[model samples]
Target: MTAPSEPTDASAPSPGSPNGPGTLAWRNAVFAVFFISGLGLASWVARIPAVRDSLRLDTALVGVLIFGLSAGSVLGLVVAVRLLARFGAPRAMTISVATSSIGLVVVGAGATLLESAPVVFAGLAAVGLGMGSLDVMMNVEGAAAERAIRKTLMPLMHACFSLGTVVGALLGAAASALSVSVFWHLTAIAVLVFLIAVVAVRSIPELENTAETSAPGEPASTWRSRLRASLSVWADPGVLLIGAIVLGMTFAEGSANDWIALASVDGHGFSNTAGAIVFGVFVAAMTVGRVIGGPVIDRFGRVPVLRACAVIGVLGLLLFILAPNDFALYAGTVLWGVGASLGFPVGMSAAADDTRNSAARVSAVAMIGYFAFLVGPPVLGLLGQNWGILNALYLIVALMALAGLAAPAARERHRR
Candidate 1:
């Protein structure tokens, strides 16, 4: 396999320059990947209720099943870097997208045909593995695309993901209302998204070819050496700190992904359709926040912006859990969405502050952030089983507060 190329600096070729088409193509490509990833993941999330009912599962069983996705994601992280090294980001993305699409098909089949919880869990694991690798590749591509544009575009790229989620959630709601079979809904959506992704990936520039300049006579790092280097990044204090901050942020976000809809139905008395709408509202709010976050981060800096977001998240969660009326619940969902928007993307940008080791550092942060999903499903399951789904969300409030305290770790270090 060919050695991975180094990433170019942000100053290399601004997309606004006369030679803009190439840079713009890459940016659009990354956005497409982000959108597809979000859509596929949310499509599955929207069906969680249907799947649970089909399998006759309780809250605890639902949580255990969701753990399959998390476990797959963790495993994906281990394999993705190597794939990126051998095949490049675009190719790796193609492979991952295909994997997720197939996994979704399997999940749908299991739900509709077999009604087997284990089969569904296996499918979710497959989806998670693909999603995990896709997450890393897309972020790596987004960072490279941001550099090419010479702008703070991470939030915008993430916003595309939220936009996709909105679309997926709405579609999922429609599917549920129509009583569409899980197999048909997901399989059809997967096919449509896979086609779009195929077209989008064609535009990704060869990012691996732009490696940093090396000293005279220094050999390019082999795959084994690259793997070793990636593992070593975990030891860096800054990276670890960034990872910790992101852990809280991801926990907040992932919890919503897995639980918000269920909470609305179980805690509040909404039907599945209404529950999905609430989830959609949350994603829409996140989309708005991410759409507007770029300028805020550029002007105020990542640390301050993230801190404010954490505070808003805490307020949102409290209101969501304690609100006495549906109106207040809806209001809290909006606050929660907006508040949770910036953390993951900003943390990614912070981890990639030094472009030379961006791919590896990003891998490290993503692994840490994803751990939340790994632990979230089962933990929240038990909590919900004992207390209540809405009450279980209070755990995220504490996490958001911790995220605020860790915000300073994301400050860009000034090299003398």
Candidate 2:
């Protein structure tokens, strides 16, 4: 590799530098942006009763409207390759934050202006699309930033996401208690998120210019070239398997995020507040797990960490399935959180290790994983409607098992 470029001030992280605290604090803040924005959909979730009462929608119809974010996300991931190639990291990051900020504004606005189901779906789609774009770019830059600092940073970055979720959950509760209109609350949060984006924009480096044999001022990938590159990444067997493993983990995580409260209420007979607390425990455990993930990944190999996480998740889900009361419910959620924490970050790192085409490869694997997230919860909802939420959880266990088994194969494929 060419000698590392002269340490440009934009890229350096100095201990005594005056900008140091801001940089370090913003690193965590950026992760929070990912986590909080992710759970932004959930922000209004607690307020759903208020919305339904205001809009006069029955439960069945309300269910269909929930698909906005996932649909937008899947669509965004499908096109993320071309998006990143065209805009590069800095501009791409800016656009995603800007778009998501708008999404937040719309979501808050929808609470007041859009009473019809279709209008609600439109608002959700905007959030999802913005989130989808933001997710890919953050991870892409996250991986690059970790490398520039010469350390294992993905886990900690993701841990901040978990931390952000915790904060978002609290923020939602506070907003609800204050009787803050969802519109005003989210709009305020969006402004904060936007300012955070602006401050961190400088810290995000350009993509590493991975073009091969550039023929005299070759341009970035157009749609055709981006498609070819995406195809090449997907064609790799290791990438394919890693994608599968991620699919399972994401499916499990999505179920927890989207369905766990409903399950606690409908299946386990907990109060709404109690059910929310159960979900909170799960997220908290995940945050703890991720905070410590960097050391775990550094000490042991990726496969071992992943396999262990899967096994724990399986146990966590089974515990929930078989347990008799609220105590078991909380414990199970905690176990699930701890178990599920490392899958995404470790999986992304593994994907990165597997392919030299880092951007395309990461995007390819993320596409499948996120696609599972889009499809998994709805399918589970269908099962819940048919056989009840308890039976639906069996699928989560099965998926976790698949993740555990894929670890060895994925790691071997990446072995040089």
State which candidate has the highest lDDT: 1
| Candidate 1 minimal-lDDT segment of 10 residues | 1-10
For candidate 2, lDDT tens digit of each residue in 242-352? Answer: 887888888887778777766776788775556556666777788898888778876887788889899889989988877887687778888898888878766776666
> How far in Å is the alpha carbon of 381 misplaced in model 1?
1.1
Over 4 Å off, model 1: 1-19, 88-90, 206-238, 354-361, 414-416
TM-score of each: 0.88, 0.80
Q: Which candidate number maximizes TM-score? A: 1
lDDT of 1 by residue, 1-416 (tens): 00112233323334455338877887888888888888998899888888887888889889999999989987876687678778876677789888889999999999999898888999999998898878767766776677667777766777888998999999999999999999999999889878988899888765544333221222566767667767888889888888878888888888888988998888988888888888889899989998998888879888889999999999999988887999999999999998988888788778877766876777688777777879998999889989888888988998889889988889976621
Collision pairs in model 2: none
lDDT of 2 at 159: 67
Query: CA lDDT of 397 in candidate 2?
Result: 93
Candidate 2 deviation (Cα RMSD): 5.7
- 94: Cα error in model 1, Å: 2.5
lDDT of candidate 1 at residue 27, scale 0 to 100:
85
> What's the TM for model 2?
0.80
